[model samples]
Target: MNTNLSNDNEFENDAESRIETEVSSEVESTPEESGAEENLIEENISTSETAVSPTSAEITTPIEDNEAAGEVKEVKTASAATSNNQGMSAMAKGLAVIAVILAIGAGLVFWKMKVGTHGESLNRVTAEDMQIILKDANPMQLKALAESPEQKKKISENIAQLLAVASQARKDGLADEPIVKQELENIRAVVTASIYDQEINKDKGPMPQFGYISEDQVKEFWNDTSHEAEFQKFIDSKLTLARESGKFPKDKELTEEELKQAKDDFAKIMIYAEEAKEKGRDLGEDFNREVELQVKLQQAQFLAGRYAQKVLADKVKVTDEDVAKYIAEHPEYDTKEKKAKAEQILSRAKAGEDFAKLANEFSQDPGNKSPSGELQGGIYKDVPKGQMMPAFEQAALALESGQIADNLVETPYGYHIIKLEKKGEGKDANGQPTQTYDVRHILITTTVKDPTNPMGREIPVTESVKAKLAEEKQKQVLDEIVANNPVEVAEDFTVPQPSQEDLQQMQQQMQQQMPSRMQPPPAGDIEPPNSQEPKKPQPRQ
Candidate 1:
């Protein structure tokens, strides 16, 4: 029964089952329950997308606020239980795995592919040419612009803002302004250098599950010429399997002709490879490195994920007692800053004010507000540790239902004031830590230094001040564009703001359908793999 995959698949589905059983909707929930968990994905990755900016007509017209926030994810039930159970011996499973491996002997045939060289070269740019680049360019260049992890989160938004700035320049007839001209030119340079430039990066960077390779990997590998044959082999294998598998549930089996055509489309990229070098606009070599890498990265990521699953997933151990013992031993987990913040929040809660009212009025967390601008009504239920920031999870585990934190909890996202609504191992059967929490919180984000120009040049501003100024100016420009072209959002594009509970449920469901992802350790704290220090425990994937 494909025993090699049995443990891997089950380890993947555990979270799915738990969230499936207990995720109640926060369609009526509180932001305090956000617990810094909302920022988890944001803390690690930036995706690359090739956005076709709004046409001039789209620019002048009232832009659609197509961002929607009403999604409710449906869950996937695990297939019927397999013969293998928790009691199976390690040796028995190993032997079964070996048997399966031997039965599926490999025959990898690599064929050399000739790359195509047919696209227009992006050598020189005129004013009009620059304008097109600005309008059509996406946030790919934003990757280089991100110097810090926090800045990376803002890159996409900044790209949108930059696009707005460019559009306003056109409307104001300031094409020749040095600032306008330079910004557009810089954007063009960034765009022309990118490999595959068409997808919008909404998946928070990597394909979840595999956690191995990503679009960024595609870019890095694109410049290397050695992977061409290897990549083609990968494509042939995947397409061959797809052709045989009949493409899953809907079963739109690939026709013979369709398979041939698909193969041809892939072949053309290789045949046309040299064309990329023609334009010589400094976009670099003519190899279809991006295409080749894209093909390879998917498989590479999956392989890595598989290896980790086989070797590491079983090492994770979580139980109610384990969590309680964890809390008892990790006193240093709390910082002086966090302790003070928790004390202040506790004082406010003890002053006899309604807790929910305080969460609505004073909490700055986005989770507090729903898609419809209504405050999410109740407590967040059955939040697994995997769904929460590690610090938040630790702090929550230290409390029980109706129990409030005596000290503050800090995570990369912010300070959290937690009140555990419910706590038990059985709350979520699918989560890594096994236990879950029904919790509420008040989030206090660290403040950024404000822009202050003390004296003129004699008493200069700090680098922080300079950065803040740039931010303020950028915002002013975006505000102008919004004023000129008010947003008229598409109904489908409205961003859904599910409650913390709903978010956890949906995330659990989504992860089940995806390749188990590897979320990087939060910024700065991530150590190199060879470090002698203990490794941070990752959320079981």
Candidate 2:
């Protein structure tokens, strides 16, 4: 197998090129040769159980834990999710980024084994073998990706690449580690059960051969006292982690129905796993290696998430007192005084003064100012209806072109003196008719600018302070982890840096590959005072 990791786009293009070349060549083959190839592919369909894709595993849903409260939730400050004051939680974003990094590292191993051409010739693994691997790796995508010889050849090569890394892991004694061994077993059980679920769920006839788990089975599992205790311990640990990571509410508790459902789920998993073992699937070296590679990747993600959560809770905790101190120190962020200043600015604007000039001189919104402190006159052109704060947009929309709002508009940020410079009709991105406007505003901000952030959004004083502290703590924690576990790559291990275009393409691929739950939330219309304008895709709700 050739060992080279190229950009994902390159990978796809190469595969397509190969498929086209193979299809053209096959057109000239004899009828006997074609029939044999078809039979080969069909025969390998049963071996799909050994398929694997290191980067394709979805995040496991966390079962509720019932442990007592920990110190992590004490002093209850704002969530780290809102640390950036952006709609998306910063902590969740960080976790997703870490997941991406871990996935990439796992991918690096497989990519190292990727041969530029069809790898079957080198390994003596035919196209049918590759088909089975691809089918099992992504059962949902099997028909579309594995029907053709060239497709199977390329996709199977990917699965084969992962085997090399898993083999290396076994040779290095990694597979023998206690934690790894346990995790591998758990993963195998879950995957085996999932495959069984798919098989039984197939619409074979009016009456299926395999029926759903009965209530008796669920009860039987729960009736075991030891099983109940084990489940409790497992759930408690999961709940504790969920609460600490802010993924669940502090008071989250399990209910009878939920417990019963969990038992039923586990019963199915265990039964299917046992069945698979009895059928000799567990003894397959290829299947074991595929699972080993997945386990390795999953373990890395779990450790990183746990370590980052601990660092945030233990070392970078932010309290309300910290925010209060920051608010008190920054007099410019005083709400009462800022409100008064906004009224003054409103009066000046209504008194026939140059609105842009007043905005340039008085608006506290840093987005309207240049790095050299040059005023931009607070002008926002081609603004969408739903893109500004409710009060700000309401006041702007109520006025006619060349008119200003009669009263100062108040929002969480502070006060806005809005002037409608232009109002017009336009088609939105979806080609639907929508209202677009150009507006100018002078803002008197109640919040302070984040000194450490380049975009300079008007985050609350407390959030700014917390963000700073958390950032410092994260840096410290990461530094210590690196120092303790030193690593140096071999001189022969070098990967060429991707170009900017490659990076953008890679980002798109990652976004597509990322689970829907982990993706960032949509942007809200109510943008902060100093942040960039919101996108104009919809009208104000």
Give stretches of model 1 more than 4 Å off.
Answer: 1-342, 348-361, 369-378, 425-434, 447-541
TM-scores, each model vs. reference: 0.28, 0.39
How many clashes does each candidate structure show, in the order listed? 44, 5
Q: Compose the digit string of candidate 1's lDDT tens values, residues 144-207.
A: 2222444333322332332333334344545444432332332222222223222222234433
Residue 212, model 2, lDDT = 57
Error (Å) of candidate 1 at residue 105 is 43
For model 2, residues 1-541, the per-residue Cα lDDT tens digits are: 1111222322221111221222223223333222221111111111212211221121111111011111111110111112122422221222221222222222332221111100111222333333222222222233333234454343333333223323333444554655444444444455444344434454543221123555677567667677666545434544444344343355556556655545555565566556655754534755544433333433443333233222223444445576578668867656877677788878888999999999878876655654455566777666545545555677888999999989987654567788898998765546678888878878776665556444634455444554454455544544444344332212211122334544555566667767874756677433334334322222233
TM-score of candidate 1 to 2 decimals: 0.28
